[model samples]
Target: MKLLVLFSLFFVLCSVESLKVLVLFHMPVKSLSILGTGVVRHLLNAGHEVTYVTVYPLKNPPTKNFRQIDISKNVELVANDETLTMGYVLEHQIEKNGAYQIQVFSQENARQTFQNENLKKLIQDPNEHFDVVFSDLLESEVYSGLAVLYDCPMIWLYSMGAHWQVLRLIDHGTNPAFTPDYLSPNDLPLSLFERVEELWARIRWQFLKTFITQPEERKIYEETFGPLLAQRGRTLPDYEEVMYNASLIFANEHHAIRDRPATPQNFKYVGGFHIEDPVQPLPKHFQDLIENSKHGVIYFSMGSFLKSNSLPKKLVQELLNMFGQLKQTVIWKFETTLPDVPKNVHIVHWAPQPSILAHPNVKIFITHGGLLSSMEAIHFGVPIIGVPVFFDQFTNINKAVINGYALRVNLNYDLPKGLSAAIDVMLNDDRYSKKVKEMSAIYHDSLTKPGDEIVHWVEHVVRTRGARHLRSPAFNVPLYQRLYLDVLAIILAAVYLVKYIIASFDTKKAKKQSQKKKN
Candidate 1:
């Protein structure tokens, strides 16, 4: 019995190996950082040492194994830059040129990151080492250079659903015929014209990437990483090749929330991983309002990026007037104080969204359709009315609408009536609640919890020395071979040759016939 117990202990000790991990999530968005921190927290809990490069550090006290490198100044810079706001996005019609805007902004962000003194020192240190590097798969691929510098496996974490552009990194199959672009507001089963539009968008993006984005990124890559490679007696790899060399991609998406496209073996879905289990209790005021509401509680937030204060005054008045008439209590996350408040409306500068969503009396969520918000709503089984502002918010809302759990309203001055009607329908209808609850069940029904799955995969990569076996074979194949363009060219040449020979023979026969006649 003693020997068996010792053997069991030995096996357990052998199974769990602590790894040093480097996590880079410098998007400066709280939602994006939340996803990264989720992975960081789980890794720490599992006895791994973590060095987190973040704009938002963990609020909880740091443990011995955790090290946070503060980059909050970057966040402040972005926040203070009015040009990066939603107002500018609207005023300049930025979404029309979102690809170019994103590329330019990402390059600038990466440039600043590389210039940070702490980050620079970390890179310059010869003794610094990490078993694996996890980075946000935002528009910036230059950060992947860190993994290359460390000589470790690279993993990408997408804060939202995986789109075609990022999927191309791992050579995952993408069919625009059915799958909509991340920025596109359209849903599946597209019409003929939509398919044509989608195809054109893909092609145009490819051209832009080749001609514009790639060159810009390469310049930054060479400028930043060239010296580091020289120090290590190594040469810089191709920028595009380094970006494509990721061993795993963990996307914050699941089949229950959206259509499942064909993905590579290395692509894993871990949506709703950030939602706290056994959600914490709401503040006393919030709890009282929710419990005492006769009809139900409605939660409204535009997420962290789009501030309610930024809304046009006339539109805000309209929303306030609309909310004043609702029978249910409304908890609005408004950044500024408004005078002449409605009796049934409560304004909060900040909201504990997950806790509020978990409340039994919370009926409907009025949101901007950000992926994290959508996932939280689904996790707690609350239906939402999405007023999407830009980018993937449109796509996220469209998916919820298709899933039958949410309604979408455009953000405009005259949206109060439409929004009121949507709220009324959601409040009265039971179908929306039922569908979201069903989705919540599906979201919860996974082999292991998302956090566990993430840690397992992270350790798995480190344990297996980069898990090269899991990579898609398509990664190695050239585009011409993959698309069979070379084969098509050969077939076309053979056909042309046959046609020429047949035409020549016919001409000779005709000439011989003419000669006979002449004789």
Candidate 2:
């Protein structure tokens, strides 16, 4: 048995082969950046050459295997989009502006990045080539065209849950009965109306994508890649085929976090690949602070996209007042300092989130329930008080609550009381921490490291020359066929035909009887 195990390990180590890879992730969000960077780092460490195109570029300790095209200027525009501020998002702009606006903005960002002189030059070079293309599954399909341009397989990097929006590219869409919409806040066992609404949301999003977004994306694809393809005397690939022919999707999802029933085989869960093992040590002052705290510490942060300082002043003061009443020292990740702060409260413009979470003296985490934050909290085995602001944050927080490791408080109502209650529950009720610790054990129980899985699968796809066997046939099946609507149509037509024939025979019999009576 020992000899067999040793042979298997040797085979696995020897099977790894280095190849060229292209990474296109133009989204400016921090979580997406971290996820993309993790994949790039793993591939580069395995002796693979990479060309990374992104809005957030690598800054230090540059390696020869990696080449970067920095588009941080366009990323700045996206981050500072006037409508995307915390104030606007609080006013429900995310829902009101809808996915359509989001798609338009994403396309605009992609267009700008692809048109950059540096990226254009990369495409113009005849010597440039890659074995596979890994891209962020943002709203744009502009990057999917790269797979066709390079004549290689494509793998989508889904930075969050399995959003129904991209489900069409892999397998059929998930059943709305159990799978919640990305924009919805509803929990499972949805009410009849909520179920109908969820279905409607899918239909609505499909309509928008089909009629509105895809056309624009295709145009961008043609404009961006058409000339390049023509220069090589190749025909432009079909937009739908390019979009749907992904070899695999590496989603940042885990059953321990969200229990999904019917995700496709090609969709691999590699959620915590970005989390650090043997987490980095804290800065000296922060370490001292955590060590000196006698009553333990409550860490508060509102992830990256939303500015915690931009929250209403009234709510901030109310939260501070509530924190003042607690025995636990409060460490808040506020972007700015507050005047007349409580003696027990410590404010930092920026906090080392993972380091702080790893500290033994931290008792509970009050968070915005972003996926990265939630995963980090679980990684460190800390219970949570979730304050969900928008989008999938609501669903993530609710899942945490259902998992028994969290309590949620809405950002809109009863700020002080709700926060205090959630904090109290997390700190006093030992059950929350205990449950989270159990989950943390399950989270780390994978047979191989998530990073190794990523590199192995990426190599597998290249070794098999596209790993086409892993893809689902559902991508080729039309929506009508997948829903069995065509079968339903035939059955309904047969029933109507039978009823018509029977009614005709009955009419003839009645006519004959009347004729005999008259004679």
Candidate 3:
């Protein structure tokens, strides 16, 4: 009886020591989102103990062993935050510029969703030693302390919408958005002006990084986390260490979307992670309508958050006019009722997006260039015409154009005729269809399902103490240190001393020679 009790005690202790991970994604969850769904699935399947936290509630509850931590529960939302207005406006403009320069000194296009209060709640717990962390890079500073508190490796995931900072932060390259010279998709050799653009962007990003990552910010954060460390019997890690110690930098996208090289060793591309549930059945009425329609279908949607009807009155009118001109049936995912509806146009507040995309007769998708929508179009072998309003929509369209799978039209009043022309080109031409079909095959191959890859990696991190081998050593090396300016400084000082001494000796010799001649 004593032996059996001792063995049972031993097993319980073993379980506690096994791999533990904390996956933090402080973003709003949208319907059929792969980040929210796929991450939970992967972490659970990997057998690593996982905990998820967010700024807001998830649409679908967490599955498997993952527990969703409603961060609002622990931290109070600012009762009256004056900063809210500036913050929101700044975020919008930042998205527009495809770059962010905060206060003209600190600048990068990473998400800042982590409120100060969120950091406090994470550290208040004395005993939290996660083996590794998988964190969304946006507002990653929130987990800066958590990474240290656990004394573990971290994997930084990129925004589902790719940006230039992904290369800059994880791989130590310049932001490609600002420095398009180095990245030419058209296969054209860059001009001298383009070369200057690349060089200036590199210089600008370096300056921005130096300005933003300050000693003061680190000091304040350490001060906050120090108390938590004291309780746990651990010392605090430096800010540089906290930032660089991540194991792998993954993204919420697949390489098919953007397959750029990482200039540094630490970044790995395991994207296409926006996994969604299987296609759901269409509602009875919608299904019946689709079945009865003789002509092929055309699906129109503006995505969530932004209402297509919210546009200027003329813009809405133009869209109706264009839809009325088309012979194909239109299923418009408009959130509100329009003043006049065409016979062929159907408006619904919401639609099962994946299902509508799956319909065989559905030819082209009109979207806001959302990542999910773009991915869906590619995944289902459908072509697209994007109307970019904001955010990654521009990049999405650019990539789609580069890939020959889609076209873009800005929200102009003239869009009725322009949209009609673009739509006619797509429907008449077979190239877009062939291109998207080719992309779809590559998007989902037999071996690497996005969900499985994410699971394998999440488990790899937990199993191998964050698989620290994947972390970038460049993060540990300071920017100045990376430039190797110490060596340069030494060389310059030596050269200057030599030049001064040589000149002095040469002058003295010349004077001596002159004196000798005069004597």
Could you estimate the TM-score for every candidate?
A: 0.94, 0.92, 0.79
The local distance difference test score of model 1 is 0.86
Query: What clash count does candidate 1 reach?
Result: 0
- Give the poorly placed runs of model 2, Cα more than 4 Å off: 1-16, 90-97, 500-519
Tens-place lDDT per residue, model 3, 77-108, is 33243332322332343234322323121111
Ranking by TM-score: 1, 2, 3
Clash-forming residue pairs, model 1 = none
Q: Which regions of candidate 1 deviate over 4 angstroms?
A: 1-7, 83-97, 507-519
How would you encode candidate 2's per-residue C-alpha lDDT over 1-519 as one tens digit per residue?
A: 999999999999787667999988788776688887888888888889999887778777346788887777676656656555566565553532366777777888887878788888887886888999999987777798888888899999987788777776888878898888776888887999989988988888888888988898899899888888998889998888788888988888775775665677788888878876667789998999998999999999888777876667887898888899998889998888799789999999888899999998899999988888988888889999998877678888888998999999877637689888788777778999999999988888888878889998999999898888887887778879878999999999999999999999999999999999999
- Count backbone overlaps in model 2: 0
Q: Which scores greater on lDDT, model 1 or model 2?
A: 1
Cα distance off (Å), candidate 2, residue 19: 1.2
Q: Candidate 3, which ten residues in sequence have the lowest lDDT sum?
A: 102-111
For residue 115, give model 3's deviation from the true position in Å. 6.3
Expressed as tens digits, the lDDT of each residue in 1-519 for candidate 1 is: 999999999999998888999999887788888887788878888899999998887788466898888777677547677765555554554433466777677777777888888788888898999999998877778888988899999999987776888788887558999888887877888999999988988987788778987787888889888998998899999998898888899999886866867788888988888887777889998888899999999999999878778667777888899999999899999889998789999999988999999999999999999999998998899999998877788889999999999999876655798899999899889999999999999988878988889999998998888788988888789989998999999999999999999999999999999999999
Judged by lDDT against the true structure, how good is candidate 2?
A: 0.83
